[model samples]
Target: GKGSHSNDVGAIQADLPVPSDVLIYYYEVTVKDAGERGVIAVGFADVHFRLSRQPGWEPNSYGYHADDGNKFHNSGKGEEYGPPFVQGDTVGAGIHLENREIFFTKNGKKLGAAFQNVKATLFPTIGLHSQNEHVEINFGAKPFQFDIEGMIAEEREQRQLAVLRSRIPAHACHDIVCSYLKHYGYAETLLSFDQGAYTEQVAKDEETPQAFGLEDRKRVRNMLFEGDVEGVRQLLIGKQPQLAQLQEDPLAVGGSGSGHKGAPGEPFGDAFFHLSVQQFIELLRQDKIGEAVEHARSSLSTFQGRSHQHDQHLQDVLALLAYKSPGQSPVGQFMSTAQREKVADIINTAMLESSATASASGSGSGSGTSAGAGGG
Candidate 1:
């Protein structure tokens, strides 16, 4: 609504304060009519801001006025800021929480920072000082005229780079990287990194007892990644004969012959399901539709109706067959290298967890021997 008189300055504040959890918060306003005084203002103000007073005329408030293009905070006096906005002009205000700075934009062009060290639980506010001061506010219901997404991305990249540049002991960093490689079964990379160690401390750390069956885990991971699902199955069975038994009697998980309280097949069932899906995907990728269908019927059909998640996954996997170019299909994400990596990561984590469980239980029955099978 338009202001009734010069002193009848009208202002409005959002019901909620600007969110501080995020890296940035911003809003924009389009001046439909600058009116008699062209004194429209857009900024932020604390809860105590008076509705009848223009924002920035009192304490704990900030504003950019239209007539003079000056910014005001905690005072009636204004400071030089950006170009004055008028009718048909779009203006924006933003708070960068990381830097504690407030800035404005005119017609989608960013103005420099207007205030520093802004520490207030402020609300998005607008002020009208005279008649016909028509304006429209956009609180991100639509695309922002400013590239706020890009700003957030840049901030995240800068923060990550800062962390990377922080000082840390070389041996400590090497050990962390080496552990990551070993955990993911990147045996070849681990070997290369070990050989490239620049100091004796790193070389000595390498001699520490590695995870059990590091080579086996690496081989299975490589085979899965290479689309050799059959090879992975064969290798697992050869290395851990118990896996063949588990496949025959899934209820025998954890080697608790009589009362195994866990889910039937437990993690092994999960691993084999993922592997079967990956095998089906690989077959489809090779355009062997008949073979893929047969494999799905033999392996995947048994997993259906087991759970909603399993049914949904099977549906998505089968959806790929309807597309001549599965890579471009809606379900194409399942065909990506990322999908294979996801399965491999899950398998690796399952193996590590099973081995850790077996070692902790101190079972002389060699339950850890089937850790790789459990992952498969």
Candidate 2:
């Protein structure tokens, strides 16, 4: 029930049938009578209610209520913000759904407020000032409105991408890029790929073999980090047949045979060859040398003949096998048992030292400073 108090300069009471365990009543009080007239500065003492467990009514605790209002969760405890909203030109009040954030305003303006974890309905009390000082208490019922913020950085990134698509180049290798996009789980947005003035791709001279250079390496790196592992894997699988034929009977880019017409004896860098080598190394570390060697041979068959450096690395890896432990290690097959133990000790010590250094470096690299993931 809503009520109004006129030029009365005394305490008074109004009845409300709010069986609500969580009651939020908004009030607008204009203290027109300036003659020492103070109203429900803190409306808590004036509000009253009782839970279903009780037959009779009791004073509702306004300081704080446990699950006293609506809630999607059970966050413990609630408190009022700021001092008791004693007096203002116009005072306002509101109650948050149990632990819910609430903004109360008088005449649509903000004011000091209290919060609660209110569950169930309630009939809360209100006052003009100090439990009915010669002040007016005017309150009305209203619905609560809410707003929430999301990942702004992610949203900003999406917006920027949209702007770029409107201003960049139109996709030329549209089909291939679309395939990549699908592989990466991006919607087929080839039309929106760029927004700048569109330009056609310029043809490059292909007579030179080194011309491709590290460009393919960059392409591989982008593909690897693009998070389309399955799509990339599928692409790799589809190309595997071609790669297999190329390996079975090596041919130049122009079909010059064996090595690309002018392809380097070993064009692959140590890093490039290490992916498969490390695969075998890990297997060997697991004491699966037979399986490791099998994997190594297969990888070598596919790639070694194409690169002289890869062939050399394969030899080094074979030699590394000669440095394994005494009982189960492969090194003992080629080296004496004593030599094997000595080599094992050296490798272990080096690894420990390197690990220690890396740990120290990683720890020292940060003084707790960091920015968002997309920060430049």
Candidate 3:
């Protein structure tokens, strides 16, 4: 019915049918005029054929009064709440079926939780106790003024993160991955990983082995590839002194390297032996015969009594001292680019394996794992 001032006391209701008791139902009423008495009410009411001048004038109806900003329910009891509205004001009513709560909003701003413990099926209803009162009702055919979907997505994301947190502590995982990425010179990838996985605050808070820093350790490997045997020796002895003893006693390697506690396995005798041979080759290549002889006496002699392969390799390195250019010698493969790469890989493998072990034991020195694994 079209409510009018001529009706004396007019009441109107929408013909649009909505679910009475499932999900959330929201409706808005815009007051075009406050009427001669400034009295307008909008709310929910039962469906059976009973109508009253005001919505809550009947049983099982809940109405929010626009004039006094009060709620009227159960025929008489009224409570002051919400914001009073006049002409050109919009009021919204939302009923949450799951929570059984009724709430109101004024001009898209929530007035607050108004009623709790609500029940029963109802329909959108409006009533006017004075002439000229006019209101328009909208039954959620348009967008909501609030970010309800965004709120739901945020809640879902929080739940997922909570599940991930139950499986792994976020900070510890971030530290491990970041450390591994840094070890391998994956700067751009590490940057993206950090930005996505952690905030600036967390990345800045992590600590590591400063003496054997990833860059410093990687530098030693690079020097071996470049045949800068002296640089590799100084770096290892300074930043990773334990590496020198990696083959000395085997048990001496049992203690932690870089302050990480773990039982060491497989003495890196080959790594040190390769490094020693590379130094001897570089010395001979420099054509400093006297120093080459001294280097062989000091370093190469130690391998003479070891494996037959080691003895043969030592004799080959010493023979390089007699050549004007070792690259043209019969055993020139020793000076080939491939040989340097192989030696670098051997040393890198030793370091990566040691770091992975320490990491598994909870005290990684950040050397990373194998080439395909971690890369330091």
Evaluate residue 199 in candidate 1 and report its C-alpha lDDT on the 0 to 100 scale: 73
List candidate 1 stretches off by more than 4 Å. 1-6, 170-376
Shift of residue 201 alpha carbon in model 3, Å: 33
Whole-model lDDT values for every prediction: 0.75, 0.35, 0.64
| Residue-by-residue lDDT tens digits, candidate 2, 1-376 | 1113322212233465333344233444444443333323323322333221111113343422111211111121333343233333444444544343333444444544343444444333333322233445555433222111112222333443344224222344555666677788765364465332224321221111111112322333344333222333233223222222333433322132443322221122222244345455545555888886787677655555656765775676666566556235544332232332333223223222322222222322222311111101
Best by lDDT: 1
lDDT of 2: 0.35
lDDT of 3: 0.64
Once fitted onto the true fold, the runs of candidate 3 whose alpha carbons sit more than 4 angstroms away are 1-9, 20-22, 146-376
Q: How far does residue 20 in candidate 2 sit from its true spot (Å)? A: 5.8
- Candidate 2 wrong stretches, greater than 4 Å: 1-14, 17-25, 34-39, 42-59, 63-80, 83-88, 98-108, 111-113, 128-133, 140-376
Position 160, candidate 3: lDDT: 36
- Weakest lDDT window of 10 consecutive positions for candidate 3: 367-376
